[model samples]
Target: MRARTWRRIPPAARRLLAAASAVAAMALLAACGSDGDSASGGTAAVEPVTVGLASGGSRQDGSWTQAWYEGSQTAQAELGDTVKVTFVDETNSVDAYDKSAASFLSGGGDTWIFATAEVPQLVDKFAKQFPDSMVCGVEAPRESYAANICTLLPRFEQGTFLAGFLAGSMSETGHVGVVGAFDFPILTAELEGFVLGARYANPDIKISRTYIQSFSDPAKGRAAALAQMSQGADILFSGVDQATQGIYQAARTAPGTYVIPQYFDSWEQAPDVVLTSVIYNLQGVSQEMIRLAASGELANQHYEFDLKNDGVGKLAPFHELDSQVSDDVKSRLAEVEAQVISGEILVPGPDVLGTTGAGSKLDLATIKAE
Candidate 1:
């Protein structure tokens, strides 16, 4: 998704707002001690810690980056006075990431990190350079570091499945569309789950899939969505971030066509057209990580959150289309959710250039029978 250009708010005004928000956040964090046990029965001493955040994009983009910001805010609220977040904006280069990490470390940040798998080398370099500082890389594994670095990834397939169910149930044309940022394993997992879910709900469901090759191109996303709709797709599910707003806009022109948003609830963008959202709860995960850090038990490992962990999942807020969804459909969806969380329903593993990854291939026949 090409990032939407903001009407330049004077740089001074922007800086002032950022400073003010940071001050307010710091105050809030100060009031909340690092008490992890208060929420989950893990009593630990409250400590004042300073953490830094690095983003590949702006916090206002309403996408993956915003989700990370939300998580930082939650950590600030729950950890009080111990957290400070500084984001690197429009990070499109490795040099930028390296500089951001170095700056954060030099500035005394207890934890310096970047979100996304695109900056593997930068993350690895920083992990080695600042071994004392905790480092977090979101959405991919930290292949080199073992002690001071950890990776956080979401079970995005879980949410995609729910979105597929919505599309399959609501699609009038029997065709649903998916817009992806890239053709990577992660994106493929989302597409696979969505296709599987749609097929599970309706055997004859047809899926139209496309990759924009970039995560910041709104025009591309909009055009792809329009093309799919033109080809008879009635529901659009996007794995791209801000570009999804373009998809929502495209759906509006089609009246009854619906869209499923990524990262956060986008119903406000098109109340009549947006079916529901497959949201990521980064705030919850960030808070948990901060608590673990405070307890000195933070480990370098891949942490995957799913419907079962309340880490990543779906939200079908009752909207204009609520009445159209049958009671039996809702009940069946609930059953599907339970089965997925309990491991009874397995989403297919990622396919590499059309080949399935490790794990038993999903039995499509059995899934549809359920």
Candidate 2:
């Protein structure tokens, strides 16, 4: 009988096991059949590969999870009959992390397991337990793990810096705001980059930053955005997930106010007020990793995608206010972008917050430490 007790394990861990088994199964199947001819008949039968995606929240959360779902879809489409995709949601809890991962591994998935950075310990534990499984952890570093484990981290700081410059240029009141999901190290890094970029563009700029503490709380995000607007903020940048929609809603009622969307494109919400957006191209990365695993070329290393690889960057079409931004300003922004990509300009690290280094000047010590 097919084992069913493994269902109790987390989806992420289950995916790990499934991927390892699939790789082994494929190898065994290939060995049974001769290279030029099938062992039993003239035709060779190919088995469908199963891929499990373990997420920290619902797939429809309209933020990070949603972006991951898109990547999963892309992989499924590219792999066609060779792969079947399944998702296990963790529901934003520590217990859910292990449970979901374990469940995926036990479910008989062949390859491709995706996870968030919030549960690094859980991922490490599972990687050790299932050495053959291929795992990809998003937004975190992978350390001391099996050969099948990898990481997917983006250069969010680079994109946030560009957003800050856009906010600084668009703000008429010389004041801007950032509504963050949480004060985690990753989010803090984005905030630091945004504030620094704004001040670099305009020394007189005033930044009002606040954290909603929840990625899915639209009401709280709306309140935070409105509070900043009331305090003379003309441009609002969002680090919150779906809550960014709430900020856009508030910006619509008040004229001359702008907001930046996170992850995907939010241009449809407030075309006039939105200066630009920071988009993460998770689909491309997912597709590449999936292909690598299928071809037995999966590497046991942490892979970071940034402006250099087009993994993370800005997306603003320069809608209505395009004419307002001068050619000189655009030229300077382009130069900044080149410098950042070429390593001439380093986005300040997390330790520089609330100090003199918070401005245009970057602390070499912090950058070196990172």
Best of the candidates, lDDT = 1
Model 1 worst lDDT window (10 residues): 351-360
TM-score of each: 0.78, 0.77
Each prediction's whole-model lDDT (CA): 0.72, 0.71
Clashes (N, CA, C under 3 Å) per candidate: 12, 24
Candidate 1 at residue 101, lDDT?
79
Candidate 1 total steric clashes: 12
Give residue 70's lDDT in candidate 2 (0 to 100). 78
Residue-level lDDT of model 2, residues 181-234, one tens digit each, is 766666777776787778767868898988888877788988998999999998
Candidate 1 lDDT over 190-292, as tens digits, reads 7777877887778788778878877777888889999999999988888887777678778878888888877777777778877888876765666666666
